[model samples]
Target chain A: MAKILIVDDSRTSRRMLRAILEEMGHEVVAEAVNGEDGFVKYKELNPDLVTLDITMPVLDGIQALSLIKKHDPEAKAVMITAAGQRDKMIKAVKYGAAEFITKPYEKEVVEKILKEVLAL
Target chain B: MIANIIANYLINKGKISLDQYYEFFEELSKVRAKLGLIAVHEGLMTEYQADTVNMLQATMDMKFGDLAVEKGFLTHNQVQELLRKQADPYLSVAQVLENMGIMRLNDLDLLMKKYQVENEMSSSSIEALKSDEIDRIVPLFLPPEADEYVAFATLAFKTLMRCADNNIFPIKGFFAEKLDCQNGALQFVDGDPCLTAGMCGDGNALLGAACKFGQEEFESVNMDALDAIAELLNCICGLYASELSQKRITMELYPPQYDDTIEGVGEYKTLIFPMMLGDKLVNLLICIGEKLEFRYS
Candidate 1:
């Protein structure tokens, strides 16, 4: 089981992630609405993993990922993207994002990638 | 669309074997409605006139409509009307079934007449509906075996109305093989119960949904506007997936496809629910059990 933080601008996304994580026996330590809030939550929660949506009103995912990595190089992070955001995936990788999950994501794939990141 | 109805009836009556049924649609898939036939069908021209125009095109380098216009057999407006009718799936299916000798044209017409009469129920039901009563309107458009999708479709209509246009309204849904539109977005869910959903429109029809949901005034429907449309689909898919997940039916979204000139081809029947958004029309299409080949664009 892992301690996870989900940060997304969409309420739907936050709730869905929380449900999936809880069902998988992992604990969702916190949920944040955007990247700036996500960064603040990471500092406070010190969770095992964080999932950040790539776009948000304040301090988008890539920017927040940079801050989280600088704060903890070993942080396990997954970046959520919609289509046409493939170009940004390369940038997220450079910023040390562990994996990428696109929207309308399948459960098996998301679980596999997140587990792989946790194992690392 | 009529083909499926007749096909199902034939199966239930044991008029055709299962193998024959599959073979019929296999042949039906090869059928494409031609302009000359449609012109004759619409009584805009005679069989003799269409034949003459086809022969003239062999000696000249012009489109059928253009040559027909040159020959004064059809006006330019009439040709444009024929071109639009060329995409009609009903005509294609009827032509194929007639050529295959499976059913007589007269019998097919009678079946269609009966189908249309039964279908008047939904249209007459619509007349009783008050404006702002979309909840009562949504179910009338869904196809059979769509109970799971009722809430999904309802939320989609509500979201588009609240976030994009206040006065958007959906017409009755019908089956079509394909839809041609200027631009749009679509996403799919793959799980125990698969699903496909999409929206598209021509010209400035989609501009309202794009700008209002995006919260940006796009002068025209551009890439930025399309991206916003994709995001809106993602948002809807996310909500739907969550609801289904609670039922122990896990669902996940495939990437949303969007761009200029989306062409969707449904493997089965594609149900299109037309909506009046702004001054133009936008289409909402949903298919169950299989991915439309983009199995739709």
Candidate 2:
């Protein structure tokens, strides 16, 4: 199992993603509220993977993912999106998001994405 | 219907045990049972009419639609519509599998069509449900299950996962004439079929969920908290409407409203799906064919 950092504005989403990550036997190293917070946590925690929610109040997921990737070009990211956020999804892919997951969360898809991303 | 045909074919070829055969049909009937409830809920038949037909089914060896029609409970056209519901088993299951990101779209559709062709079942009926002809977000058979009244479970589960802690679990859905709610938010799913969807709760549970959703600690369940819940509902409902649009169904979403004044929510046949968000309980209500009425509105 790998370590993970969850970044989303909604506390509810963070809890849910944490629950799923932990259930998959991955350690949740840290959690952050927004993109800036997420980037800071990413550098501090140095987890194997970071899951980012695309929309946030301050400094959204894309900006955060970009910051982390700039800091460490090898950084792996998974973008979380609501359906029909195709434009944001394309941007996430451009910024080097390893994969994408859509909400509301489906456990099986989350597991598969993690497995493929971490190769574990 | 596709599931049964394949299961029977495999059993006849000695591929699966007779035990597996019975298990398959037992599970198949569970899916079919929801059709009867949906028929009643859709006003295609009365509860008494559905029940009498179900009772006759055991002794008569007749199909459900034929039996209902023979008893003068439904017209031939109504039975055809019900058959459309029967044709949806594979597509319903496929939607779940697709949502899980495990299967390609139309894989199950093609597979079921092949099975229907082999069994000499009506392929046109299957296509009718899948065609531009039927355009609704919630199909005759819904995802996670076939019952329309219970279909909100998927949305409720998603809402809680997005706005509340993941430890929350849903209680089985049931028909409630009225619900006592101190704080509530509701929005109408207008157009095509007039309906209402809302969230209602009081005390710790609603407040806790609202706090997480809003990222704030609230002392009581107020309009602010209700507004947060309403916003979550609105977001998902918009996505749901978007999905329906792809199917060519036009739906109207009204502005979500929250009220602390209503003592209760009721009117029409309200389908309530209760959930335990940690230690507190909240209810997700959906009223089909009519708008929800608030007590003391």
Q: Candidate 2, which segments miss by more than 4 Å at Cα? A: B1-297
Top-scoring candidate (lDDT)? 1
Clash pairs, candidate 1, are A104-B253, A105-B253, B292-B295, B292-B296, B293-B296
Q: What lDDT does candidate 1 reach at residue A117? A: 90
DockQ of 2: 0.08
lDDT of 2 by residue, B196-224 (tens): 88888875458877777756677787766
Q: Specify the poorest-scoring 10-residue window by lDDT in model 1 chain A.
A: A81-90
Clashing pairs in 2: none
lDDT of 1: 0.73
Task: Give me the candidate number with maximum TM-score.
Answer: 1
- Per-residue C-alpha lDDT of model 1 across residues B258-295, encoded as one tens digit per residue: 77655544566567777666446888877777776543
True contacts kept of each: 0.02, 0.06
